[model samples]
Target: MKGVVILGESECSVKDFPDPVPDVGEVRVKMMATGICGSDLHLYHMDKQQAKKRGERIPGHEPCGIVDAVGNGVKKVKEGNRVTIGHWLGCGYCDQCAAGNIMWCEERRGYGGAIDGSHADYVIANERNCVLMPDSMSFIDGAFIACPGGTAYSSMKKLDVRIGDTVAVFGLGPVGLSGVILAKAMGGKVIGVDIIKERTELAKKLGADAVVNAKEDDPVKVIRDFTGGKGTPLAFEASGSAKGRTDIVSSLCRGGKAVFVGAGSSENVINPGQLIGSQLTLMGSFVIPLWMTWEMVDFISTQDITFEGAVTHRFSIDKASEAYRIFDEGKTGKVVFEWS
Candidate 1:
């Protein structure tokens, strides 16, 4: 088996390793497609010493593939089944695990982070973590659902975006782009904000009603004026920057709701007074729960949503370094590695 390993300072390589075999209740998937997420870039940019700490761990979580083998206790997933493995693995008996919120489990292990991930030809996963892909969904679409798409779906569910509602999405990265697509499908008028022109343009192509170049205009004022001085009824923050976080809160109409899904910055950007004055409902969302992953698959299928439009680049695993380089530039939509 060959897997991609981060070599620090924006370098990566495909190295050979022994093929992974599944244990009880586990399954091994032959990777068909996987995505390079924003979180993966954090590992890609790590210093030499920091990267060394990762050892042989492969770094990718968004995976979609065919089941190649199953362990002794595996029942629901059989060899040859198409599936997308949820990135979080947890102790099976915990309440959180039972509810499919494996990421909240006390003993949770995340693929590509705490364990060897799916950036390889073969990756292992618990059977419970594998969600079957519909016949109509492409492997790349399934891969998106495993992470960014699912994250946006979770946030949208939290916001309960209604028809005709104005949704201001801060940050036009993959997750934010997914938000625009999903919000538009759910009938919200989307306003996308990003400092990069390329990203803002991509958002428009993906169905955003309007886009704001934050470097040229105040996003809050733009959103407010766009909404006729009321601001948006809903907002999603996926930039993970301090300014983005602050702007999202300020861009919402009074009594409106917003959900934060991006992770990176540590700055204190919230103003309690504003929250009190506007009577806003601010929530934070992580990746989708395992149960919701199945629901998301169904939602995409029933709504006829197409995520392929969000993908801008694709490469073979052998070109892992090049893939990471382009994605790190932060101008593209979504970068993926596909296998035939």
Candidate 2:
């Protein structure tokens, strides 16, 4: 098997590894497509020690593949099935898992850094974490839907996105773009904000009714202007920057709701006075719940939202280093690594 690894800061290598085998309750998936996410760049920029910890750990989380083998006690899927691997999995018996919130699992294993991830010819995954990919979806789109798509869907549902709602997305990355697509499909007028001109343009193409280039204009002012000065009813922060979170919270209508989906800095600047006086609802969104995962899949499939435009670049696994370089430059849209 050939897998990509992060060696150190600005250093990456694709090397050979032993073929992965399915353990009990697990399955061996023949990698078909893996999406390169913003989180993957965190590993690419790691220092000597973080890189050391990432040694031999294949660095991809959003993977879709064909199940080549299944282990004992597995029942959710079978061999020859196309599936999307969940990056995070908890003990199946945990109350959280039973309740469909795997993010709150007691023994949660986000299977990228500690456990070998999907940037390879093969990967071992817990059967509970594998969602059977619908035949209607392509492997490339299905790969990203596992994470960015699922996260966007979960947040939109939590924000109570609805018809006639002005929804603003504070970042134009993959997650932010996905947010625009879903919000529009659900009948909300979508506004996308991003510092990068290319990203904003891409957002507009995807589904955003309007896009604000934060570098050229004030996003808060532009968003409010578009919404007739009342501001948006729902907003999402996907930039993973404190400033982005500020824009999301500040650009809300009275009694509006905002969900911060990005993992920004430890501390962010938000006005408690505004939060209280405006009766605004602010909350953090995590991974998708099991029930919502199905909803998201169905919604995307039926709505014909492929997010294909967001996937602006593709690379074979051999060029993993180059792939990360372009992604870290932050100039492109979604990037995917294809194994087949």
Per-prediction TM-score, please? 0.98, 0.96
Give the alpha carbon lDDT tens digit for every residue of 1-340 in model 2: 8999888787799999989879899999998988888788788878989788656778888878999998889887799998887777777887888887877888877767668888898989988777776798888767867788888888998888879888999888888988988899889999999999889999988878999888889888998899899988899889888888888787899998998888858775888999999999998888687666666777777877787788888999999889888888888888888876
> What lDDT would each prediction earn against the true structure?
0.93, 0.85
Residue-level lDDT of model 1, residues 77-154, one tens digit each, is 999999988999999889999999999999999999999998999999999899998888899889989999999999
Best by lDDT: 1
Query: Looking at model 2, which ten-residue stretch has the lowest summed lDDT?
Result: 290-299
lDDT (0-100) at residue 62 of candidate 2? 86
Stretches > 4 Å off in candidate 1:
none
